[model samples]
Target: MSNPTVSRIELWHFGAPLPEPFWPSWIPGYPMTENRCTMIRIVDSDGVEGWSAGPELIRERRGLGDVVGLMLGQDATDIDLAQQRLREVGYFGWKNWWIEPAFWDMAGHRAGQPVWRLLGATEGGEVEAYASFGEVRSGSQRIADAEARYEEGFRTVKIRVHEDEDADIRQVTEVAAAVGDKLRIGVDANQAWRVSAFADAPQWDLDRAKRFADVCADIGIAWLEEPLPMDAYDDQAALNEYSRIPISGAELHTGGEPELRMMIERGCYSIYQPDAIFTGGIDQTRRIIAYCKEKGVTYTPHTWTNGVGFAVNLQLYTLSDRDKPLEFPLEQPSWIPECRDAMITEPFIARDGKVQIPEGPGLGVTVSQEALAQYGEQFFVADA
Candidate 1:
């Protein structure tokens, strides 16, 4: 058996222009873009590599130099320690959440199994994907595009309602009028975490969120995600109570354990979508899933960051037996896996609009280092 040692921790940034700009219909004030993924890599003692990534804003970690060394030579096999180290570094404004998948990779390698198998998940099950649009567009355009999306294997879709109260009303009205019964729609407030780097991203007020919730309910929408900021526990709880459909939040909360514990107590989400990367790490995500299961809240890990980020969280998503659908962020030309995951070989092929559980070893993801060499810009590489 391999004694799983942490020989190297590497971070790579690889981005490609999107085929076209995609401004989500919901993020009212954001601009569309073609910029794509920035990846993460981790190699264990045995020379095995595992990869993950975040989108668009690449090279954010050019200065990870002063930090990654803390993980050098540690037992990658000891996931608890790795998770702790990652969480501890987060206190100083640097988020090492993307590195959490490294521990799962090491854990799987040491145990001679795929991470999913080790987590007790069954392979080859199809997970339904919702068409999560990234471009901001009008209600008529949304109706036409969503109609096209239905033919493209998506039974459900998520659109951004970017602070246009009346426009939001029109969009929902069109959706219910056009295909509300045929397709289930979920609106993403995306207010859980704001991306202010871009100048046009619209911010949502609490009143707008509540009003939107009323519209969502009136339209027979399936669920509403992140209507308020992720930490606004009281507001989230209150909205969840009155919202006709399910209420959900918690994507970029790096405070992790404590924040999730508080949300669980306050019943902040009917469905808690914690991104494994943005959270503490794999073990901490495992804890979140356990809590959700115990509390009867649906457990669907968020996967919108990038391809590898999707792959890492998919393993965690399979661990829960909620029998609920998972979020497989696929919206045509702009955010499909082909472009969102262009660097990877088998970029999660969704069949008839659903993805199957992976059976391969590690996180069931393999990155072509040669491809990384071609497109990836190595920002941080630590080996001892």
Candidate 2:
């Protein structure tokens, strides 16, 4: 059969209001009121539709017409050409790597297979998950939350820390004591991609990371994530060597394969977490996963964006041989499964702390037209 040609493209500014205000630890004092993203839909000549999304703080992609023009007549299954087109767009302005997944989604649908199977997975099944908390709360409240997660069948949980040295150490110590050995705990410093746009965020130096690592080691913490800046290659390598526990980061690196390869060669982190949407889409991320296997580095992806972002990464995660649990972004009252996956026909809710891999064609989740009518605003549409 001939390759499917792109026949139409559409873009929408999608936003789902949160039930309550959510103060993300990465941004310090900013109150996030909605889950916002730019959604894209690509329809081929055969009428098979593929979808993808990118996180957005505002409607900054109103000028995406030029990018859409480049994809108008190209073969939707020719991902190499798709990557080249996206890279060409990056040369002039924003890194639009997030949009590349739509090609994979399109190809998977045409082949009548899941994205993971298209990427070479033998079978489709469920994968373990760790409850990833987004905010820093009092130690007492965190302990209660941890216990609740444990009850829900999550064997592991990741907490946030953004205070002074003493307070940070105390927070982990208290939670570790509360859970004992029943739960494995991980701590995210959120320093790799720090956001100071709305308020002052804490910055971590080598000394501070070392001190925190020492406490985490004593408390048997599973891993410490993004303890230093994303570009601090030399410091990250040094800290990884110094720390008794495993060090992990690299989400939203935006440098693609070459930069990630350099870090792997430098022994930057024991574990490498690259979200496919933010890194360089599925193809580049697959290369990163193979490189991690060759270098003996752990490869688990970051899945904190919206439902589409999570689906994109979940497909990539199945290609890895590593057994690390996928990051399941869950925070109560605000970033729940329903709101995060408002557009998806079936929300990816974790049962017993494990999410069943979607078995449908393409990215495996169906986009809800009704929900789109409710939450998405169509901003651009074009036909070849």
Best by TM-score: 2
Q: For model 2, what is the C-alpha lDDT against the true structure?
A: 0.90
TM-score of 2: 0.98
Structural similarity to truth (TM-score) of each candidate: 0.92, 0.98
Q: Against the hidden true structure, what lDDT does model 1 obtain? A: 0.74
TM-score of 1: 0.92
Off by over 4 Å in 2: none
Query: Which regions of candidate 1 fall more than 4 Å away from where they truly are?
Result: 24-38, 56-58
- Pairs clashing in candidate 2? none
Tens digits of lDDT, candidate 1, 202-222: 566667778888888887888
Candidate models: Cα lDDT each: 0.74, 0.90
Give the per-residue lDDT of model 2 (tens digit) for 1-384: 887789999999888889988888888878889888899999999898899999988889988866777799789889999899989999978888999999989988889999999889886688999999999987898999889999999999999998777888888999999895899999999999888888788899999999999989999999999999999999999999999999999998888888899999999999999998988999999999999999989999999999999999999999877489999999887889998888788889899999998888889888888888988999888999
